[model samples]
Target chain A: MTHNPTIVVGIKQVPDDDEVRIDPDTGRLDRSSAPAVLNSPDRNALEAALGVRDDVGGQVIAMTMGPPPAADVLKEAVAMGCDDGVLISDIAFGGSDTWPTSLTLARTAEYLDADIVVCGEETTDSSTGQVPPGIAAHRGWAQLTYVEELEPLPEANQLAARRDVEGGYERVVADLPVVVAVAFGENEPRPAGLHRKIYAENEFEPVTVDANDLDIDEETVGLEASPTNVGGMETIEGVDRERTVVDDVDELAEAIRSTEVFA
Target chain B: MTDIDPSEYSDVWVFVEDHDGDVMSVSWELLNEAKTLVEETGEELVALVIGEDVDGVVEEAIARGADRVLVADDGVFEPYRADPYGEQFRAMVEERKPSIVLIGGTHTGRDFAGRVAVPTHAGLTADCTEIDVAEDGVLQARRPAFGGNVLATIICEEHRPQMATIRPGVFEAAPPENDRDGEIERVDVVVEEADTLTEVLERSTGETADVTEADRIVAAGGGIDGDLEPIRRLADALGAEIAASRHAVDEGWVDGSRQIGQTGKTVRPELYVAVGISGAVQHLEGMNDSEVVVAINNDPNAPIFDHADYGIVGDLFEVCPELADALEGAEQPEVTL
Candidate 1:
């Protein structure tokens, strides 16, 4: 039997932004106590990858690079139907920006011989949406971004995608080894199967791969190699308006009735 | 470590993008921003155009703001393949380095800008809403982060040609200054036949409402309680465009193009009426620049009132109809938004 297509889905563990609070004294996000959750859109990416596998009888691989605690998201992805999960974690990869992050993911996809790679359009924390394009650039592979729909043609070694652009959406067909960036709320994320969920939490211990596991040079994949620096953050304060309450519709109507805007 | 001396980089460059001979508006907006910026830095602003027979775009770029226009006209540039386009700009960036490079955050812009940034390592920032030069001469890009909960200003001080993808409608576009003098330089495009590139098969375009240009907007939000006709009636009565918050759009009550928020569109309409909108931070990021804002909601503490010029705390269903009638009968009231 021929080997099945290997689709590697990239996921991220970001701070639960809803639970995040600002350190009013420092004017910075207090992520220290916040819990980490699988990025919302990333779940859609995983669902897309798994859906492809369901149709083509292939395997879906969940991959992520973060601290040790990040392995939890991998477990969640595996529980969601991925056949395997790989976590690339190391102190050397710390402080890496999108460029180096893309390098690391590209190398992992290369080693895995991925036929297709998928990622959320952006992360909630950084929300740059550059890593996927960076990966496509680093790998010199065709990149389909902001994809809302995916059609897997396993026999043809191509994936047809419907992506959004300026005025409208277009259907694009790209050769295999392509990177697909899924748009937010593209698909309804499926629930993890009951059988998978039974063993997902207990049986999953992601295969950990450190920097040495790959052939990439250390100099090219760390903070030192990153070009952009987070210099400072200035908050864009929301507007504070007068909370006026008009007793009757006529009073409010009369008040706004003479304004040049509506009349 | 090899460092690029700040002194070597001289000009502010913008990618002049044209798709199927239709020039993108973001290019003009960026050129306007560049014009304002270059005046501050005393640097020449250049527009780099890549396409075949792009003489019209060349003249347009010059009229817009560019002190100089560089055109790379060749057959390979047709239909826009990523490899050749990215390499051509990368080569130019490496040869005649600029202090800053602004690319429109369009479909093609994101594709090539991301690729162009790799080897150049230009410290690319995506979806930047604001770009400016810091006191230290570094390019500062301010963008939304943490799901629009906060804004972060990023700096790429060490890299030459600090690159950024600017979302459209974030900056206002002005008409071309025809009286200005500018020069056009032609450059040959180099494409490798051996490189594999994705080809476009069939192309089609669809029209969406442009709320950014709407002088008056009547936007609905989740507070409408599924009855949009009242708001629609008000919008019809006022001859205003209908816009919505992300909530209404996501809830399938309106088209996504009409959504006004950080993730949607950045708009600065003349008059904006927010009905049933709770005034989320994300929604405010898009239309906070409106000349006048009026919010109507039953909840007095709704955040929408914070930015509104006038607030009416009452049920929208009851208030919208009355306001529509009052507006229709006020003959010759010097109507404006």
Candidate 2:
């Protein structure tokens, strides 16, 4: 409806996979032990949002909800040329499943009056990939999932997307005010911009929205409102097969021919 | 947890994906799986088929394992959309309350699952590898996270109809027995266009190879150089579908449609050849069910060897060209899904 599109990207900070350790007692990630880093896929969401803004003028708002340390990712997003950043943080928002998580995000989208909300396909910690669609359903908006590439047509208030589906690729379109789930590696995330970084450090202070800031229904804004619970957790590993490497190409070829897989 | 009684729910239900009378294989697989969950919980097995002319799906579900089949045949259900499809389940869930609902983890099914979860306040788990009944009668849904590094077991402790979209290939479809007796109920469903937000512009889905259904797959990973011609040639020679690990997909060496890993498709092909694959736990999780696996890598200690039945430690640049030459004009086996 405006001259410039309003793109909102929901980013998250997750435990670095390599440095993560599972707490055997609680069967949950030891976040304190593992340093927090941006959820890798969120880069694509930011990239998609920035790309749209670049093609047609727009404001990119990067948002996240976590502890104070999570502010680093919003800074990184700002460094990457987002027009602004917002962090939704509070102790009451911890331990949220997709339900409450989306409630918080949906309210933020409303608070920002975002025309489009972009999200990573899944988070490394939960890997549920439900929050995006949950937000769309709660907001009564269109949703596109696993979108590899998307472009907003400003005049028509429509967005066309290339979606990766079960058996093949599909071209779909949704009206504005839709939620899009961008898969990892959709586009190369641009390196942090020099001007944006200067702005992030000197002139920019991220707007923090807590429970008191928005019209959050207390009954549906915290972990207490989530429908799912972690009953238990266990580590799963692949079975190890014995190794016998062939020395030469000829031997490898011979082995391949005789192998049951080929037969 | 809420004070809701577990007795309020009565059966284990599955969403049967019936597109113009053609039932997707995964729905049948889920029906078979729901049979197992029903046994553990001592509940009835039911199947929900929504679409016009889906009588074949309903009958087949009854034959396979469903004690009851709810069929919603309406013209509005012709095109599958999340909002309408979600409402069909939400209305039924409100009336007939099933303890658990299983769906195939397809893009359409998962999006629909998410919408339904909100309306019914059901806890939804996507891409679940396994599911069962807990000792306390709660649904135990387990899924791999962080590239298969850990398994998280989740439960809908406060919700009804603990829902999960099970990975398609985890369970085999049960053989249908026409003689099996079952009950069928016809549902009345109506939808307003305003209730749905989006429509598919152009659907080009049937052409691409669904790696999950490919009997033989040749997968490439990060160890492979930018050149994928060699791997493509090898796959062509063997009449196998091409699959890629996350690394290969991320590197643009292959398409993500065929990626095999925790974040991609879970495959159970009969023969899998991993060329230049280091076998990240994520990659291994997708194809560990293959009947046989052959690994070709230069690194002797590459993690792929741990899951491969045959290991060949050699430079793929040399081995691939040589292997291509050796197998040149060789007979390509005929495989079927």
What is the C-alpha DockQ of each candidate? 0.54, 0.58
Candidate 2 Cα lDDT to native: 0.81
Q: What's model 2's lDDT at B220?
A: 88
What do the candidate models score in CA lDDT, each in turn?
0.81, 0.81
Worst 10 residues of 1 chain B by lDDT: B328-337
* Predicted candidate 2 versus true structure: per-residue lDDT over B100-212, tens digit per residue: 99988766677778878876778888789988887666888988866576688888877787899887677788889999999999976856656666777766656445677
Model 2 quality (TM-score): 0.91
Query: What's the lDDT for residue B255 in model 1?
Result: 71
Q: Tens-digit lDDT track for model 1 on A190-222?
A: 898888987878777788887888677788778
> Number of the top candidate by DockQ?
2
What does candidate 2's lDDT look like per residue over A147-233, in tens digits? 989977778788889887655567777877899999777789999989888888888888999977977766665678887877776
The residue pairs that clash in candidate 1, if any, are: A241-B306
Cα displacement (Å) at residue B289, model 1: 2.0
Off by over 4 Å in 2: A21-33, A254-263, B1-4, B18-22, B208-210, B213-215, B223-227, B236-239, B250-257, B299-301, B324-337
